[model samples]
Target chain A: MDFSQIIPSLPSLWDGMKLTLQLLLLAVAGGIALGTVLALARMSNSALLSGFAKAYVNYFRSIPLLLVITWFYLAVPMILNWITGEFVAVGAFTSCLVAFVMFEAAYYCEIVRAGIQSISKGQINAAYAVGMTYSQAMRLIILPQAFRKMTPLLLQQTIILFQDTSLVYAVGLIDFLNAARARGDIMGQSHEFLIFAGAVYFVISFGASSLVKRLQKRLAV
Target chain B: MNYNWDWNIFFKSTGIGSEIYLDWFVSGLGWTIAVALMAWIIALLLGSVLGVMRTLPGKVLPAIATAYVELFRNVPLLVQLFMWYFVVPDYLPEPLQIWFKQDLNPATSAYISVVVCLALFTAARVCEQVRTGIQALPRGQSAAALAVGFSIGQTYRHVLLPQAFRIIIPPLTSEFLNIFKNSSVASLIGLMELLAQTKQTAEFSANIFEAFTLATVIYFVLNMSLMTLMSLVEKKVRIPGMMGGAK
Candidate 1:
């Protein structure tokens, strides 16, 4: 509705989007890696490892992401200081990154677990027959297939992560949504700017989802 | 910053003997449950109707349902919360707007807006689960009901819906948990829900660790119990040899 406000504010919004993207990319990479380890741990023969991973995933999954962000933003620095005997300032970005990575890892762990489970047990055994260790077998044989099957799902979760990065606004981070809000308040067009931001969010998410749907279809074939 | 841990501060009064910090968490939990339950009802009712619409015999009905899902589902809950808070009040009729803005208690008004926002957002997701449930049913069941001279509504009520609902309980459970978790976003709009209370206590006591750790444990307990309850219900309602009800 207010094209005038949105045009000049594009740069500001882009800067915000860059931060959002940075959060997204970092979390996805770190989360998936952590998630894969958690998944493997959950599937491992050792009850201790499996139990720890299960607890981590369950605890993270049960709590709200917003709470996790708040907790980490506040508590991480405190814990760091307690350990080091000096006050440490963990910025909003790092705290949010840590929260997202940890939180999203649980969801990603489930996805990766399901993907790995879908692969036949025989395949892993066969890899073992060739004298590969568990990690080596998983890396050389299972992971490639699981990653392929899980790609669309991982992307879907990434879309969710993209949308969720907005919550960084809670801890005083200037993510895209907050940036738009800032610009909007400055220009006395908060309503229009918010509407525009919402539309932008809808388009990107909808577009990404459709792409996932397409990928699903292609993978099906 | 030498911070002394005060685990007992939750039970102690906040220097005035008016209320313990834990009282804030209790009330916040109460509001959280109220908001989540009310929103869950709306999600179930509206979601089922929209889901039914999506699966109906008409083209327009499905189209409308599709649009509703796309519009609501794609937007982040936080943005939607903001819209409901700031934008929707402006669009209301003048008297209603006044009631929302002036006549109603600030907390009550915020509660109402949050419930509506959360319900609508969740309904979109629930709609998908319900649709999948209905479509997952055997086509012959609906046809059989119709052949027995049952109206479409009767067919759905007696034949299709009962089974579809049973099939969807697991997903619906997750949706229920989601509503509880998502209720945290209401704090952004100044509703003193659980997360908000935890933040407030952390700030007041400087025992951020104890406060959030306690909140996390409570959330875990709530969610785990819900999961256990739903699993029991699923087991009870499980129609043997059915798609989702299989043990």
Candidate 2:
């Protein structure tokens, strides 16, 4: 009932929010870029390229995000040491960013693939008939249209990613949730701080989702 | 890397206990399945009701259902788990708070909170699926049922829901698979699920790669089996003239 503790904790919580936002924006950008390539590779005529992309998506999709985050957190340092022949300290932020981008690419790849598929086959044929190369057709004719169609879905996924950034706490990252918990521990009001954090998360996620819904409605027309 | 690989670490004794690392994995797998199955049952049951409410011919009921879905679906699963674990106990009345916080075993309490949190969170998603399924049904079906003297409840139970549920099998399969994957979050609250076991094994044996690799394989196998099983169910339940079953 006493939410008085949340006011004093706002400064630290704002720092945590910055980390969460940073992770969200970075992962969305990186994941979408990788996902677009994977979608192209998946739909390519070359069996090897398609198979690799398919396997990558399936592997990431089959497992939980928590395990992926943990794996990157634990294995990165060892992999770095093996490469350089000395121990290396890769921070939790870097590891989590790597994990989120890689894991989310699988999902984004599916979304992008669906988006690309939604474009009519005739459009690609027309692009090729005009002497455009495969890459050129995709880059100019197909992708622009697909990207427009996918904006709402991509934004919806970003909202999901924003919620998921809280999982970086697994690797001791000072995400908003972690920062709230830390402040809670020091202030002996863990429940109040947690409630505050949950309310904040709910507000952001719900508001973004509503915006995405409106955008979807407009796009449909 | 010049690091030595110990593939046999799963067979080695933990020294502090009689069990090997393999036993830890087996037990962890058991907990994972148990939590996922229990939570899935609750989510399905609760979500079905909420979904039906949203589709029913009333504003108040649908508004309530929408509110529930929006509230539960918006919050992250981890924060919800933390709230249930840390906050719910303090808000309970005096004797119940003591019972939850003190009288009950820590792991048991953690298990209960995780299951409840996950079920509520997932129920919101399931509600959407069910609502979509119900709404997707042709309006003629409801009208015909009503014209034939069927009550609203009877129409849903006999005519609407049966067809709607059949139509949504594919999406429902994905949701069912998600419950298993989402159950891994229980480890965050100290439930010692498969991921937690993997972390412990890595710490104990220092075979970080081996531990995670094995856990990943196990999860993959588990999901593959579920996918196969659900597909079989989907095939069996498919209505001949319906969406996926159409020739």
How many clashes (backbone N, Cα, C below 3 Å) per candidate? 0, 0
By summed lDDT, which 10 consecutive residues of candidate 2 chain A come out lowest? A1-10
Q: Which stretches of candidate 2 lie over 4 Å from their true place?
A: none
- Tens-place lDDT digits, model 1, residues A34-70: 9999999999999999999999988899999999999
- Misplaced by over 4 Å in model 1 are B240-247
Best by DockQ: 2
List DockQ, one per candidate, in order: 0.75, 0.86
Model 1: how far residue B233 lies from native, Å: 3.0
**Candidate 1 structure quality by residue, lDDT tens digits, B75-164:** 888999999999889889999999999999988999999999999999999999999999998899999999999999999899988989
Candidate 2 residue pairs in clash (backbone atoms < 3 Å): none
* Model 2: per-residue Cα lDDT over A1-221, one tens digit each: 67888887799999999999999999999999999999999999999999999999999999999999999999888888888898888899888999999999999999999999999999999999999999899999999999999999999989888999998888899999999999998998888889889999999999989999998999999
Clashes of 2: 0
Q: Model 1: which docking level applies?
A: medium
